[model samples]
Target: MRTGFRSVTAVVPIALAALAYAIVVPVTPARATPLPSRSAPQQRHVREVGDTAITTMDGVYTLAQATRGGNVFAAYCKSCHTPTFHSGPPFRAKWYGRSLVDLFVYVRREMPKNAPGSMSDADYTLAIAYLLRINGMPTGAKPLAADTAELRRIRLDSVPAASSPEGPAR
Candidate 1:
């Protein structure tokens, strides 16, 4: 008998037995662990600014941050996204009412598809700053902090209306 033929015959029975065992045996789903209790303080998405809420409408990030974000996007994110993907009405519609923290968490956890969360928190935050700039949000005197707690303060509402040369219309 040929060596290959003998090996095939020997393996077939073992494969068939394994298959039969799988079919015959009942598999139970793993028990789910209970979620942690909310003993931690709740995070607030809105930051009060006098009578108004501080949102993306106000300057939350800086031009320098946005510029660095552009480079980051070109290096890592451009393969999957066009500049247009981050701009205009569609992006705003999807992201509106979500806090910057939501964006930061999402990108940090699931971006770069092949290797998620590879970038530092600062890079992800800068990428968000770029998105904000392209969408026509104003820049602040301060750069947007990379910290999640700071990011949570800014709610991403609608893209603000275009302001006149002097300032936003009342």
Candidate 2:
């Protein structure tokens, strides 16, 4: 009985120590370390359209075109949808960080639900410009081309800094 009690006592202490260690080790915070920066070449990788790093200030489209698009949207799209609907939080949540071209294509292919692809390519591109404008993207001197390749190069990120009052300095 004496030997058994000693053995049990020894096992209990060991088990309690292990339990305490296991509990305390995981709860302890780990030391933080700074990550290494990427090389210039490594940082220059091809950026996708929806990348957060991309913005609309890269001269992707023109304000004049967006104005024309606004007219087009009023004529054809107003009956089915509202301008606010396309530029509101829901729209941002759905299209932010996507390809501008992808949105254009979808609009061209499946928009005006009653008659899809009914408008001319120029009109469609203009409509896209209007959408961008409404979403707070700044317009440039040049018009947005109807070409897919050109559009693909432009991304749909957050509103450009130029649009904000506290916009980035140049």
Candidate 3:
């Protein structure tokens, strides 16, 4: 029932906080060292999030951070991108397997229906990996990267033609 904090109790917390800060704040020799900058070109160090892993030709990533990304997607994207509909076709009558790499690139480039490129690499990879999994691709030991070089290698399987459809393409 005491909505207002008594001055005595408030003073104790403030004093304790000040005492803790006083103890933690060092007033001795400043231990500051300048780290040497890399002379060579900067390389993007792949940071693994948590459990989401992607297998790419260049290397592998165990995206431990993808779990967060999955939740982010579900909260923002599940309404528009229904898992059942994200298949080999247009959820109705269209072939989506024409270009596997394009789809991957598009998703990586823009997705989540809210934030594009704002997501961490781990999130991006996990979203794509989950999409691929839904489309029938098997998950490998390693996680995928945002690299386009590896994605172009594997062809995506769209809706197979009802019959022959002129046998491959001309």
Candidate 4:
């Protein structure tokens, strides 16, 4: 009887520990290899009047917009994230193949961690532009429009072949 009680006590803690780990660690599915080179013609998806496929490589945001986003990031996000955090594997794991609208909505809804939804919608969109620029997405003549439909139209299909380790190019 005592031996059975001891066994139960030991197993209870182990079971609880396993339950806690399962609850805490999120499981992500295996991802495909990262796509390369925004400048590749094969990689670019042209958005025509009736055509719907558009990608980040198609110049989704402007330099000025990214610059403004950098400022907003410095003010609110820099406390926790360095510019490089927005690029490379980490960014890809979270955002690759997703639409920019996902990013916009995420930041608008759950960012700043302490004060979620604190910034203007435009500001959130601009921060996403900064993230794209740092990831080596080319700047467009026009800024990223802060519209859900427009943002949803552009998907992040590929990262650039070369991203500056220091930050976005000045």
Candidate 5:
């Protein structure tokens, strides 16, 4: 059986239609909707501070970690941040939003101006703990964790920097 040019030309429109259909379908990711704020306090047991929430009221930040952290922080942080707050808030101000530890996790995952996740986990933890201490958070027996869970529980009054001109693991 020999197929002529006219027969092949007749099927071209059908193939073109199928290809067009495949290209036009729309696909998108599901996005979560923001909930409206409640007037009255619903959960009395939990401590809520605006956006930053804390379940662990365990007052456990160590001096050793803070000292080390101050070093890592000065080396990595300081340019966008200052040892004390300037424009909007002060370093000693009460924590209304995110914790110092939360900032540390964010910095560790993404920091050092150009580079992120460059600091050792222990150093990052220490840096945040140290900042917390400087912010008036009392030190405790246990050391701070490098994980987000612990970091989110504590808030920062202001960002910290290297104690002096020098930096890292001080």
Candidate 6:
């Protein structure tokens, strides 16, 4: 019994020491590297109002393109969803301030419900143009490009403020 007690006493201290060492040995301070600087041209910033590249001010798409898109919407989209649903207040509320590219990508990938992603990129682009036009966004002289990168830069918030008699324009 004394031998057994001795062994347990000796083992417990050694086991605890091993555990303490195991817990304490692995911790080390971390060093982080600073990020490299970018050139002025490489760092593009979007400004409110004046910056055409970021804001959808003068309209991103052309009226001609929108007209063609209207045709596409009538043929492929009108059956399941109405233009009002796409361009109405509810739709604007959800989509405003987001990138037009997001809308384009969604429509291209998941539109036509029964036959999603079936439409060509051109068709999808036109459809978006039409929706923007109906939603009261301005129409630009140049058509909105089908390129995703360019589309990403343009925000979808070009809706005119609503007027209120009791307070300032909302």
Estimate candidate 3's RMSD in Å.
17.7
lDDT of 5 by residue, 1-170 (tens): 24666665755664454345334522122122232233344233235645644322234466666666666556556666675551223443434355655566565777644445544566556666665655545455566665565465554432233432223222
What TM-scores do the predictions have? 0.64, 0.62, 0.44, 0.67, 0.48, 0.63
Model 4 per-residue lDDT tens digits across residues 26-106: 332222222233455644454332246677876777787788788778766888888767787778788888888888888
The better candidate by TM-score, 1 or 3, is: 1
| Candidate 6 residue lDDT tens string, 64-169 | 8778778778777888887657664766688877888899899988886755665666777888888777777667666777778667777776454342111221
Q: State in Å the error of residue 16, model 1.
A: 46
Write down the lDDT of every candidate, Cα atoms only. 0.66, 0.64, 0.42, 0.69, 0.49, 0.64
> Cα miss at 41, model 5 (Å)?
20
Report the C-alpha lDDT of model 3 over 36-93, residue by residue, as the tens digit: 2332321232122233111221122233323433454564458677765654445213
lDDT of 2 by residue, 4-58 (tens): 8887676565455435534442221212222223456433432554433334544
Top model by TM-score, which number? 4
- For model 1, which pairs clash? none
Put the candidates in TM-score order, highest first: 4, 1, 6, 2, 5, 3
lDDT of 1 by residue, 133-155 (tens): 87777786677777776676668
Better of 2 and 3 by lDDT: 2
TM-score of 2: 0.62
Error of 2 at 81 (Å): 0.6
Cα RMSDs of all predictions?
A: 17.5, 26.0, 17.7, 14.1, 19.4, 23.9
- Compute the lDDT for candidate 2: 0.64
